[model samples]
Target: MTSQHAILTAEAHRDLTIRTERAAALGDAAMCCITVPDEFRAVQSEYPILFRLSDTRDRFTALAMFGFENGENLFLEDGRWDARYRPLAIEIQPFLIGGSPTDDGIGQVHIDLSSPRIDQGGQGERLFDTMGRPTPYLDRVAGLLGTLDQGYRAAPDFFAALQRHDLLEPFTLDVTLDDGSRNQLVGFHIIAEDRLATLDAGMLAELNAAGHLLPIYMAIASLEQFGELVGRRNRRIAHGRG
Candidate 1:
């Protein structure tokens, strides 16, 4: 569906109430989300970090994997996301940082009118109070958006560093379920531990000085979550829900 994005404003959305819940109906069943280096530490703890080329194939994006296939979010169960930390990209739903028309130094917040999170029945948290000031919920959302924007701006440098070091390599995952079913995941990239190991002390120091080493390690550590994720998918298959 085409998105209907409109600049958010208290005057236009004073009564808008956003439903803060995790459910498939609210568009929370994605298998992966675009991630940024700023949130890698938080995201790596809960999800496997992977990489893929952008649609234009001119840039790379980090991804937090939640499941093996499209529309299959294993973290989402029983109306909740069973994780300690969610990627900022997923948390900032229905709202996004949009470009300012006047080339001002400020970012504009835009809302997707087609989102199911829009609760016009007044059953959710209001975006603005009666006085037209942002409520605590909206304030929190704004903060999330701000962080996301910063993360996006910092991503290119991180990807470029990975490329310069030749640390990214294509990988394929083959999974076998208890039911004897096989699944293959292809066309994704991950930090090549072998290549990373080959980096000299000087290269390592350069990455560390640039604040890229920690996140690179975090992404590598996140591979351990793949076992847990596959277990979730296995359990779902056993329950007849996979």
Candidate 2:
């Protein structure tokens, strides 16, 4: 579907409602989504945090992996996302931050008219109240968008720091399901534990003083979730759903 971006306003969207359920039709059945360092702690516990280079190959973005293959979200089941937390990027679907927030310290909200989450039948949360004022749900979405914007803006520096310290290394996951099917995931990166451990005191101090240390460790800790992720896939296969 073609995306129709429109500046969101209470006046225009007063009657529109958003379907909050997690479903593949609502664009939730994905293997991964863009994530930020600020959410590493929460995301680490649910998804495998990994890094990917942009299309231009000049920048890196953090990703919270939900499955090993495209269009396969292991955590999605029975109209719900089977996870305690969802990445902000995924949660803010159908809404995008428009305009330059950094210039004026404010952002314009744009909604995708083509998104399946848009409900005209008034079946979900209303975007605006009867008086055309922003509803509490809308307010929360705005705040989340603001956080997403800030985190997106701050991500490049964190990636650059990792590169500077040579802390990122290419990684691949080879998965063997219970049914004897094998899957290989590539084109991702992970924190180099060996390199990180061997970093000199000065380098460690630099990373710490710059506030990049915790997130770095968070990404490393997130690797443990990969085991659970594989287990989820195996379960799906066992249930004849894979």
Q: Which stretches of candidate 1 lie over 4 Å from their true place?
A: 100-104
- Tell me how far the alpha carbon of residue 71 in candidate 2 is from the true structure, in angstroms, after superposition: 0.3
User: Residue 186 in candidate 2 has what lDDT?
Assistant: 99
TM-score of structure candidate 1: 0.96
- The residue pairs found clashing in candidate 1 are none
Clashes of each: 0, 0
TM-score against native, each model: 0.96, 0.96
C-alpha RMSD (angstroms) for model 1: 1.8
| Candidate 2, position 160, lDDT | 94
